[model samples]
Target: MTFWALIILTALVTAVFLGFSLLRGRDTREPAAAYDLRVYREQLAGVDKDLARGVIGEADAERVRTEISRRILAADAQMQAQTAQAGPPVWVTITGIALVGAFLVGGAAWMYNLMGAAGLPDQPLSLRLEQAEILRAERPNQAEAEAAATPAPLPELDESYASLLNQLRETVAARPDDLQGHILLAQHEANAGNFPAAYKAQQRVIELSGDQVPADAYSHLAEMMILSARGYVSPEAEEALRQALQRDPRHGPALYYLGQMMVQVGRPDIGYRIWTDALRNAPAGAPWADAILAQLDELAFRAGVFNAPEIPAPAISGPSQDDIDAAAALPPEERQEMIRGMVNQLSDRLATEGGAPEDWARLIAALGVLGEGQRAIDIKNEAMEVFAGNAEALEIIDAAAYQAGIAQ
Candidate 1:
C-alpha cells in the first residue's frame, strides 16, 4: 500500500513479535500467592517471640503490636492507592489503543504477504467496450447498468454530393446572402463537374454577401470539400427543384424538367405548359432561336400541338439588330427600364401578330447570355412556345439559362 501504511505495518509486526517473545519467557508458572501464607505465619511467630522476651512493657508491647498491625494495613492501603494513581492519561490511552490496532493490522498484512498476490493488465478501449456489450447480451437483467450496455443506435450519415449541391443551390437562392449555403453549393457543384458554378458560389461566400455568419465554416476552395459531399442523389435535392419551379413557374430549367417528371409520374400537360411559357418570353431573332424552335417542333409533334414546319434561325449579327448592348451597358436601373421598354414594344408586336416559338426561345437565350435574367424570364411563356412538350430542348435551354445565373 502507501509508504506510511507500510512503515506503520512493519513497526506493528515487530512490536507483536517482540511482545510474544518477551511474554512467553515470563508466564507459564503458577502465581506465588499459594506459598505466601507460610511466610506470613512465620513473621507472626517472630512477633510473639519478641512479645514473650519482654523487650518492652505490656502497654508498650501492645502499642508496638498495634503500630505494626497499623503499618501492615497502611502498606496494603498504600499499594491500592499506587495502583489507582498509575492510571494512564487520555492521550496515552488513545495512543496505546491505536498502537494495538496497528500491530494487529500489520500482523495480518504480513501473513497475507506470505500467501501471494493477483492482478490484471490494462486492455484496449474497443476490447473493453466489446466485452461490456457481450456481458449485456449475455445477461440483460441489471436495470441501471443496462443503459450502459445498450447504447443508443448510431444514426446513418448522408454523403450525397449531387443532392447536397442542389440543396445548397436552393438554400442560397431562397436566402440570397448565406455564405455557408453559397460555399456548400459551390463545393458540391465542383464535385459534380460544375467547376464554373463552384467558383461563382465561392466568390459569394468569400465576399460575405449576407449579414449572417455560420460557425465552423471552412473555405470551399479544394477538391476535398467537393469530394466529401459525394454520394447518391437525395430526395431533398429533388424537392428543391420542385420548390424552385413554384417560385418561378416557367423557370426554364423547371420547364425542361417537366417532361422528365411527366414520364415518371404519368403527366406531361403541366410540363408542356411550362415549356410553352418559356418559349413565349424568349427573343425573336436571337441565335438560340433555331434550337428552341426544333425542340418545340418535336415536342408539338409528340403532343400534337401542331404540324407546323420548322422555323429557321436567323444570323447572329443581323441587319435589323438594334444597339441592344449599348443600351444594356448603361447603369442597371437604366438598363432595366430600357429592357422593360423593349418588352412593351415586343409585347405590342406579339399581340398584334404572333411570333414563332423559335423566335421567343432565341430571344430568351440571348438575353440570358447577356445576363439580363429578369428580362428573359419576363417572356418565358412566349419563349416556351418553342418547346411545348419538349424535354430535350428544354434541358439544354434550362442549363444555359441557369448557367447564366450561376456564372454571374
Candidate 2:
C-alpha cells in the first residue's frame, strides 16, 4: 500500500505542477513578425541617414528605402495577424494535463506489472533464508522421493548375461553371508538400474565387512540411494554420505552428493565452493568430474560468483601403452636402462612441478616394477602428503602402494 501510495503521489505532484504551468496564461516570447517589423523600420532610418551623408548615390539610396518600406509593410501586417490570434481553450489544456497524468501513472504501473512480480510481497534476505531452511527441513525423505520419482527405462540385457545375473542373485539370496556374492550382486544390480536392490545388497556388504568397511562402501550406498530417488538427495542419502565422509573426509562421491544436497537446500554458495575444490583435485575421468563441470557455471551464477575462476581440465598423466610396447621390444639390459631414464625424468619433473594423482600413481607402480621397493614406498608417502585432503588421490596412491607390496 505504501509503495502504490508513493508512486501515485509522485505522479499527482508532477501533473499538478504541469497543470499550473499550462494555466499560467499565454507565452511571453516576442512574435517573429514584431521583431522583423522593428528591424525593417531601423533599416529605413539607416537608408535616410546614408542619403543625407551622400555615402550612396541618390538612385541607390532610393532603391534601398523603397525595399525597406515594402518589408516594413509586410511585417506590420503579419504582426497584426499574430496579435489577433487566441490561445487554446481552457478545457483543452485541462484535458491534455489529465491525459499526461494518466499516462505517467498508468504507463508506469503497466510497465512494472510486465517486468516485475507485481503483487508479490517483499522478500528480504533474512526472510528468504528462513523460508529456505523451512523448505529444507520439510522436504521429502528417501522413500517418499523414490515413490514420487519417474521410473527410468531399464536397459535390455543379453540372454546369457541375464541368466548369469539371475543365478548370481539367487546365489546371493541363498548365501546372505557370502561377501563376494553380495558385492557382485550390488555391482550387477546397479548396472541394471536397479538401485533399490543394489543399495540393499551394498548394505549387506557393509554389514558383512563389519568394522573394516571402507569409505567407498558408504559412498556407493549413498550413490545408489540418490539414484533410486531420481537424483533427489534425501535425508537417508545424506546420512550415508556423512558416514562416508566420517571414514574418509575427502571422499569424492560423498563430497559430490553433499554439494548436491546443499544446492537442493538453497545453499548454492557452499555447493559452489565444495564442487570447485573437488573438481580442482579430481583426476582425469573421475566419475563426478563431468557432472560437476556440466552444472558449475549455473552454480557459480547462483552463488553470486560472476567472475569465478576458470575450471581446469582434469590432467592426463603417465606413460601410454605405446611406450610400454616400445620398451618391451628392447633387450633386457637396454629396456631396464630406458625405464630408469624415463623414471628419472618423471621424478625430476614431479619434484620441480607436481603432477596429477595419476602421475604419482604411475611413478609408484613403475618403481615397484623396477624392484625399487624402498623408492616406491618413499614416493607413495610423498604422494600421500601432497594429496592429504584428497581421498580419491589417496585411494589411487594406496592402490599403487599395494601393488608395490609397500602398503602400511
Candidate 3:
C-alpha cells in the first residue's frame, strides 16, 4: 500500500520470477540419459575385443547391446514428453494480464495524486482511535459508545435534512417538470423517516416517467421505496417497487427491499421466496446478499431444517459397538426423531421477542420458508385491511404485497 512497501513487494516478486527462470533453466534434459549410438559403437568394439580375447560370446554381446538401446529410446521419449512446450496462451489469460498491469500502475499513480490532495499527515490507527475515544469521553454522555454498539441511529439531522428537503421541494414547485428534483426530495424524506412525503414524491416521479423518457426514474423511485419500507411497508412503497421492477427486474435495491417488504406484510413465505430470488439478483459481497443469507440462516434454524438427512457421521478408526448395548439397540430413524424433539424445545426458547415490526416480518418469512405461498397472500390481505386507516403505512404494505405478487 505504501511506496516503500510496494517496492519491496515488487522486488520480492521479481526475485521469485528470477528463481523460477533459474529452475526452468535447469537441465530437465534428463542428462541425455540414453547412451549415444557412438558410445554404443565403442561399447560394441570393446565387446568385440573381449570376444576375441574370450571374455564373452557373440550372442550374449549382441543381446546386451540391443537391450541397452531399447531402454534408451523409451527413456528418451519420456524425457522429451516432460520437456515439451505447452500450447499458446488463452485470450482470457492474456486480457487478464493486460488489465492487471494497467490497473496496478494506473491505480498507484492515481492514488498517489489523490493522497497528495489530502495534504494532511496521516495518524496511526491506534492514535486516531484513542483520540476518537477521548473526544467521545469529553462529550456529555455515553452516546458514542451506545452508537458503536448498535447502528448509530439516524443522526439529529432534522434541520440540515429539512433544509435540503425544502430546497428540493422548492425546485420541484418552480419547475414542476423537474423529475430529478422530485426524486431527490423523496430520497431526503425517506432518510428522515417521513414515509408519506417520500411516497408522494415517488408517485409523482412514476407519473412523470409514464409521460416521458424516465431514464433510470423507476430505479430512483425503487431506492426510496426500499428506504421507506425499512420503517414502514405500505401500499405506496409496494407499488413503487412494482414500477421499479416493471422497468428493470434486476434492479438490485428494489429486489432486496421488496424481498424485505414481503416479510413485513404477513407473507413470510412470499418474503422468503422473494429474498432467495434477490440473493441471485444482487452482486456478491454486497450488504443485500449478507442480509439475505442471515435471514435464510435464521429461518432454517427456526424451522428445524438445519440438519441434513444424509450427512455421514465421522468414522471412528477403532470402533467397537459391543460396549453400548442399550444405545446400539435404537434405530437410527428413532434416534433422529428424539434429537428433533429435543431441538424443538431449544428453538422455541430461543424464539423470545423481537420488536413488532420484526415479528410481523418473521411471520411473513416463515410462510415463505414453509412453502405455503397462498397462505402468505391471505395473511397479507388481512393485514392490509387492518392497516387501511394508516394511509402512509398501508400504502407501503400494499405496494410491497403487490410487487411480491401477493393478492390484495
Candidate 4:
C-alpha cells in the first residue's frame, strides 16, 4: 500500500507541475517590438544629450531625433498588435493537464499489472532459504517421481540382439548368485532402455559382492534409478549415491548426481562447489565432466558467484622426465639409494600433505618392487583408509597391492 501511495503521489506532483506550466504559458521572453521600442527611446535620449553638449550639429541631431521617433511609433504599433492576440482557452489547458495525469497514473498501473507480481511480499534471503528447505523436505519420493515421469520410447532392437538379451535375463534370474551374470544383465538392460530391470540387476550385483562391492556398482544403481524417474533424483537414488560415495568419495558419477540433487533441492551454492571439485579432479573425457561443464555457469550464477574461476586442466601427477633421466644416469648401487630417497620423499609428502590415489598406488607399487612387502602392505592399508569410499581409486591401489604381492 505504501509503495502504491508513493507512486500515485509522484504522478500527481508531475502532472500538477506540467499543468501549472501550461496555465502560466511560455511567454516570458521580451517581445521583439517592445525591445525595439526601448532601444529607439534610448537612441532618442542619446541624441538629445549629444545636442546639449554641442557634440553634434543641430541639423544632425534633428535628423537623428526624427528617425528615432519614427522607430518608436512603429514599435509601439507592433507591440499593441501582439498584445491583442489570445492564448489557448482555459478549458483546453485543464483538459491537457487531466490527460497528462491520467496517462502517468494509468500507464504506471497498467505496466505494473502486466509485469509486476501484484501483492507479492518481499522475499529476503533468510525467508528464501527457509522456503527452499521446506521445498526440499516436501519433494516427491522415488515411487512418486517414477510414476510422474514420461520416459521416452525405447529404440527398435534387432531380433538376434533382443533374443540374446532375453536369454541373458532368463539366465540371470535363474542363477541368482552369479555376480558376473548380474553385472552383464545390468549393463544390457540399461543399454536396452529398461532402467527398472537394469537397477534390479545392479542391486543383485551389489548384494552378491557383499563387503567387496565397489562404488561403481552403487553409482550405477543410482544412475539407473534416476533414468527410470526421467532425471529426478529421488531419496532412493540419493541413498545409492551416498553408498557410492561412502565406498569411493572421488567417484565421478556419484559426485555429479549429488551436485544435481543439491540443485534440485534449491541449494545451487552446494551444487556449484561439488561440481567445481568434481570437474577439477575428473580425468580427461570423463562422462560427468561434460554434463558439469554444461550447467556450471548457470549454477554459479544462481549461487551468486559472479566471477567463477575457469575450469583448470587436469593435473599431470607423476615422475617427471628429468627425474627418470637422473635416476638412469646413476650406477646400480647409487640408483638404489636414489630410488629409496625418492620413495622416502613421496612417503613424507603423503603423510603430511596427502596425495591423489595414483600417488598412493605408485608408492605401493614401488615398495612392492623394492621387496619391502610389509611396508607395501602398510601403505596399501593406509591408502584404503584415505580412499575409503572411492571405488576407482581403490581399484588402482588394489591393483598395485596385488602386483606387490601384498594382496591376492
Number of the top-ranking candidate, with TM-score as the measure: 2
Q: Which lDDT tens digits does candidate 2 get at residues 127-204?
A: 978887898888999989989999878889767657666877887788889876677678668867899999999999
Clashes of each: 27, 0, 23, 6
The alpha-carbon root-mean-square deviation between model 2 and the true structure, to one decimal in Å, is 12.5
What's the C-alpha lDDT at position 124 in model 3?
80
Q: lDDT per residue, candidate 3, 241-261, as tens digits?
A: 777677677765566667665
By TM-score, how accurate is candidate 2?
0.58
Model 1 C-alpha lDDT per residue in residues 1-408, reported as the tens digit of each score = 464466566777676676555444344433343234345446556777877897656776667667666655655565555432224454664565567767677666676576634233446767755664564344322233323333333333335434444555676799767654565566445545554466466556646844342211222222222222241112322343454455555444434444333322323344355556656654444443444455666566555567334434533421111224333443465445534544455556655655644434445554654566777676564445656687765555455455445322
Ranking of predictions according to lDDT: 2, 4, 3, 1
What lDDT score is found at residue 221 in candidate 1?
29
Candidate 2 ranges beyond 4 A from true positions: 1-107, 314-408
Q: All models: lDDT?
A: 0.48, 0.80, 0.51, 0.80
Per-residue lDDT, model 3, residue 21, is 50
- What's model 3's lDDT at 230? 44
Model 1: runs farther than 4 Å from truth?
A: 1-238, 284-292, 307-408
> TM-scores of the models, in the given order?
0.23, 0.58, 0.32, 0.55
Q: After superposition, how far is residue 276 of candidate 3 from its true place, in Å?
A: 2.3
Model 1's alpha-carbon lDDT is 0.48
Off by over 4 Å in 3: 1-154, 158-165, 211-230, 265-267, 302-408
